[model samples]
Target: MDFGFTDEQKILRQTFKKFCEKELTREYVAWMDENCDFIPDELYKKLADLGLFGMIIPEEYGGSGMTFTDYMIAMEELSTASVAAGICAGLAVSFGAKVIGGMGNEEQRRFHLPKMAAGETKYCLALTEPGGGTDIINAMKTTAVKKGDNYVLNGQKVFISGGNVADYMLVVALTDPKAAKRTKAMSVFVVDAKTPGITVNLIKKVCIHACGTTEIFFEDVVVPAENMLGVENNGWNKLVDVLNPERIGTAMLSLGIAKAAYQAAHEYSLERYAFGKPIGSFMVLQHYLADMLIEIENATNLIYKCCYLMENGLPYHMEAAMAKIVAGRASEIAAIKGMEILGGYGVCMEYDLQRHFRDYKQMVFSPISDEMAKNMIAQWTGLPKSY
Candidate 1:
């Protein structure tokens, strides 16, 4: 099958790439890193003007109504600019707007979709707890108890991306403890960040410094029944079904970070001369550059194929898992090679390679781990997956 972009897709990529070059330049990323701030308000507004937040939403819902492939194009371009900036926008559009648009009621969609797509609101997912890191199914401690006409939620969510500044939250909670044996009885609820008894505490981290990670506390926080995304005690399917797209987005993010590192390394080798010629002329440096290219291409192909299969309605769980797993390693390899090219300069914050290195490492652990992905592949492909 031909994996080439159509004329329209090509134009879309060109448009988004130009936008990134114009708005999200290397200097802009440096400023953000220095300040330790989220993407500026004006930048977010510019993205809204571009209809970026609506990239994947349906036109009927006041969105551009584009396909996942189109959204992937946008994701890649924005990510190539800055992973923090791109994800700050992409997650709000895909996991936040797309998830809500797909399942929310008409009233819910009418009110939330337009604002989200317009960049007036942002969202965060509250799935991981302090105690439950990877064993999310059996380790969830958050509870949303039905009381009268509202559900009173009581729990804490840690390492919540976009939590500190998000206007809305998609919280996963258990509805029943007994029937959770098979898949775990969990449900998703949308809660406004301003709701009473809800607290957002910022989390200090080494990477994604521009993005806000937080610990959220729900102490008798009330959520109306209208806000439930799926059936009571049946939210596991909703959560799991959404993982494919999320994982794809993350793998793409990793690819972007790798590309950033590759560019830095490539440029450094060319300019840094040693002995009688540039370091890039040396065989050892040439070997590293070749290895970096191979890793990037392999990861990129896997990620695209997974997305293509999912869009075409195929069983692609194993493929998606593999893409995410491999891409994480690819990211680390690129960053390490890039740093080697820069030597000590790569570790300094003034250059993009240091931030890229820190950012790529974080991407390696998120959504899922490499060992977990191998286990899933083993179960599905009968290949005896082992760590």
Candidate 2:
């Protein structure tokens, strides 16, 4: 199989790169990080105008109807400029319009897709609870009981990215607690963020500050039965379908952050003189740069392989997990090496490397942790479960 980006994909990547260069300046990123708030409306609108908000959404729903690979390209470019911006835009498209397009009923799609595709509304996935992260199927505590034409929800979701600003959320809750299989007991619902008995509280974070991660409390919140996505008790399968793609996207974001850090370190090494000689001339510094490049290239290859599998409709869960782990580890290494190359300047707020360093640390643990990824790979190979 050909392992090259299509001409259209290449052009799209370049276009997005140019957009980031023009709009996502270091000063703007710094300001947003320091403010620790949602992305500005104007900037979000601009991204929508570029059709970034509809990369995976269908054209009929006012979206661009692009492939997941195309969406990954956009995510990488946007994240290279600022991880927070990349995440905000990525969440709107992937978890927002794409989910509705893929799983929602016709009416639900018609009502939500257009506004989400146009960036008039924002959406987030609310799956993780305070007690559950990777142990989602077993540890999920959220429950929704069917009432007269409605489902009453009472649960808590923590570490929900963009929860505070999102207009809608895809909530995962248990609908059949007594089902023999935990996976079959779970269901998914689309809930309005402003629904009564819902409370959202922003959680201050040390990295990706502009993304506005939050904890949401649902105290006897009522949702219409019509809002259920797919068949009841099928949310687990639907969630699994999305996880592979989301993991691939996470890999791309990690790759971007690593590449950014590597580029900075390489450029700084070439220009900065130490002991009357450029740091590039030092063997130790050269080795660090070499290791970073090798890791970045390896991560990129794995990500491309996973993307190709996705584009070809091949089973990609294993590849996606591998890609995420490789990319996240590479980013972690690049961040640390970048800081070492920068010396004291690396830790200063005035420099962007420190931000990359902090962000990569968080990225390594999110979406799925490195240990979890390893466990998945092991299980895929027919090995005994390790966690």
**Model 2 misplaced regions, further than 4 Å:** none
- lDDT, candidate 1, 344-373, per-residue tens: 898887788998888987787787877777
How do the predictions measure up, each by TM-score?
0.96, 0.97
Residues 240-357 of candidate 2: C-alpha lDDT, one tens digit per residue: 7865578888888888889889988999998899899999899998899889889899988888888778778888899888888889988899999999999999999998899899
Enumerate residue pairs that collide in model 1.
Answer: none
Clashes per model (N, Cα, C within 3 A): 0, 0
What is candidate 2's CA lDDT for residue 25?
A: 86
Error of 2 at 105 (Å): 1.4
Which model scores highest in lDDT?
2
Give model 1 RMSD, 1 decimal: 1.7
